[model samples]
Target chain A: MTVTASVSTVSSPECGAGRPDGEYILIPAFNEAGKIGEVIAGLSACGYTRVVVVDDGSRDDTAGRARRAGAVVLRHPINCGVGAATATGLAYLSNVGAVAAATFDADGQHDPRDLAAVFAPIYDDGADVVIGSRMLNPEGMPRVRRIAQRLASWSTFLLFGQWSTDSQSGLKAFSRRAIGTIQLKTNRYEVCSEIIAEIRRRKLVMREVPVRAIYTAYSLSKGQGFTVGLKTLARLFIDRILHW
Target chain B: MHPIQWIMLVFAAIAEIAVVAGFRRGKIAAKGIFFWTVLWLLVGLVAVWPDSTYIFARWAGITRGADLVLYLGFLAVFFLLFRHTLRMEKIERDLAALVRVLALRDAPEQTNQPRADGDK
Candidate 1:
């Protein structure tokens, strides 16, 4: 895909009213009705209007809640995975002529204030991909979750030969070229690592920035527990072995 | 021949014939029928010559012929189970993709809830 110079050449719009210069916020959610509305409201208050939510086959009224929140909802009829949902969101953003895209978790863990910091590099043409790293400022992060996130970072380094402080962070900002070109194959949580692998393979310029995480009991429950984290790691390793 | 040996031979012959008939009737694939027929013929051979299993077991470093056959059978069963599980996961993934595509295509153009952000 030939990325025209027009992609990064577009300037970021001042946060006043309408959709800002093709910068979109994508939320990949599954059964996150309880928090999705509040998250969207926060982003809307911050003047980020181009929000797209991929409802990942939730049994609940997640799509309804997201639509109510004024987000363009893309439904997945069955629960695919976070990876698939994110891919779907990105595909839609690219289709809608977005110059840059930012992915935020739907579980209310991400601070909406940090969306600008994550997407700034892409908006300014300073980086192709900006990863919001929790490791940089892990205040209020649980110890067990911190350890698992570290292990994920280390594993990503070992597998993809590129190391970042946090590899599984849900908050990521992508340039139009990155969002349009990166091919995602995995349909599960392993897509987090796959994104890193894609960045490495394509030799895209990547930067990591500090971002605050809101770790309430509710958000903590949505995170990968010990067993789930282990399973995710095993699946990622198997995917690497399979060259997927 | 011993009564048990005769019984084994008759059963194996029946099984082999049944597999061939299944293939002819299009109830089983050619490869599956061939595998079952060979398995049944092997059973008949073992029954006719009980010493053959002992020779095979010795080659495999197994002291008991029955133990060796049991181990091999367990291995085959486990492998088949593993394949079945993997196939099931693939099907589930495919089904999820289908559902996602349908949802994206068929969902209402206008949401029931009012547009919260207000951008067209």
Candidate 2:
């Protein structure tokens, strides 16, 4: 697990020392004020400090709650969608000098306790990007979500020849280089599918790590159901094929 | 000419006349050079009077004089649109630069962590 020091000189002393392992946590949220504080607290307790919580035009005080929870907050004036929020977070990471950034859910479905599970490969194991796969250990998975996940995963695999254990999981990590390439034009939920498709098309080194998924009634209701799933698939096709 | 076509022609002529007058007066952003360009474009659609000439022409065919005037009018409109597109491009560039800077400012500082993926 020895990383070459080729990039050390390019990084400033602050960047080199503060994040020698090249890691940061990026959380994009939309009106999750009720849940963001707890999520941030959990991550902070686990020593995950670099939390970038993007408030996607929440009428409520999602940003304020995240700030109070010690997570740095970014706000979108209007709801641009999850894709734009993630892009804003990544831009922030690159802007303020982070080596890499990971996207985690704000709905409390994902555990901040497992921060290293997704980040370790990119930081220590020399992988370009890593995905946190709940399907690898889908003990708490609901039937509806499982079906939706399977459809999304299959379509991506069929279209882009990119197959992973979990395609719809929001928990994922990205090296700086990977984020740079993800700067294409996507401003909504379709962007996650777009990222997977792009990652496969570029053949960037990616691996999936088995992780726990908490699917309480709250988190399950927060997810898109059948109709939205159909719409998401349609959008993914247009973006990956027609629009690519 | 139909009343609208007549009005458009009158407006276009006034605008074109204003441009000439401005050139003579040596005015750049004056009530002529730029504004006339805009006015010409706005009223340019009038020159395409597809039904106007048919209804108003002597032989139900486009008159040579009217046709020539309409051609020039459209040319003026297109030229203005091109100029405006260039201006819009400049504004878009500035906007993109500003957005990139604002998005990147105040990024969270990074440090080592125990990950949430539950990985070693």
Candidate 3:
């Protein structure tokens, strides 16, 4: 399917005044057609006027749905993985001169209300990166997920020499400097760890904010399973060796 | 010569002929042709004269010529596999970069414009 560049503007008079200037919400979605529209609508309800969704060559109508829901949709020609999608979103944001940007999941797991807390450190404290930590408010979070997150955090710390409370959090904010400074090479879930490593390498200030994770059956199913987690770790190790 | 030696010699001759054919078809460069030619010639010589392998094996401090050949063959396979892996990774990275460029170039002109539904 040929997806041409099209932007659908969502004009909400009531929420217009609350829109944050020069700040965009970047969502990397793959086959999230069932929930992508609602995710975009939720952002619209939250007074966020700038939303960019990178459809990572989904087999469904995710790109069309996102465009119709008032998001600037960037469609990959092939499935390049979530990391590639995020990098594409960031590159587009940088090209458009976004001052700050937040990466949010399209699976409807992340709350739009937490956007403020995620962007707070970037705008107020001059933080280069702000991570929305689910561990800070783990209420309703699955025990298995929590343990997996802890293991990932420890792995990130050991490999990158940078400790993050939630290393794999999808909800994170990046200032313009952070967006430009951090170079992402991984094309999968491993990009999360690569970002943390970039934070240490580039001397970027990072802060973690308390954010609630709304985990539904759908969201839980969409998350990385045990096998996927192992693959990600293996890829991370291979990447390290290859680049080293 | 032993039956195994005769088999080895025939295989080496076939490989040499294939290499020459590849070079004639312009699929192999001059340097590649030279390298493969030398390699196959060495293989044919060792197969015809089994004692030649022992002399090299003794120089390399390997007791058996067959053992030395086995070690060298394993090393060559590993080196080729490593090179292939690196090339594949480079291709992956390049493909991703191309995809990103295409996505960005095809992006809407006004990315930050407000939508009619109050979304950007």
Model 2: clashing residue pairs? A114-B115, A114-B116, A114-B117, A115-B115, A115-B116, A116-B114, A116-B115, A116-B116, A117-B119
Cα lDDT computed for each candidate against the true fold: 0.79, 0.68, 0.85
True contacts kept of each: 0.35, 0.07, 0.54
TM-score of model 2 (CA atoms)? 0.64
Compared with the true structure, the alpha-carbon lDDT of candidate 2 equals 0.68
Off by over 4 Å in 1: A1-19, B1-51, B107-116
Instruction: State candidate 2's DockQ.
Output: 0.07
State the displacement of the C-alpha of residue A122, model 3, in Å, after optimal TM-score superposition.
0.5
Deviation from native of the Cα of residue A194 in model 1, angstroms: 1.4
Better of 1 and 3 by DockQ: 3
Q: Cα miss at B13, model 3 (Å)?
A: 3.7
lDDT of 1 at A172: 90
TM-score of each: 0.82, 0.64, 0.84
Q: Is candidate 1 or candidate 3 better by TM-score?
A: 3
- B-chain TM-score for every candidate: 0.69, 0.45, 0.81
Q: Which stretches of candidate 2 lie over 4 Å from their true place?
A: A1-22, B1-120
Candidate 3 per-residue lDDT over residues A150-176, each given as its tens digit: 999999888887888889999989999
Q: Which residue pairs does candidate 1 place in steric collision?
A: A70-B116
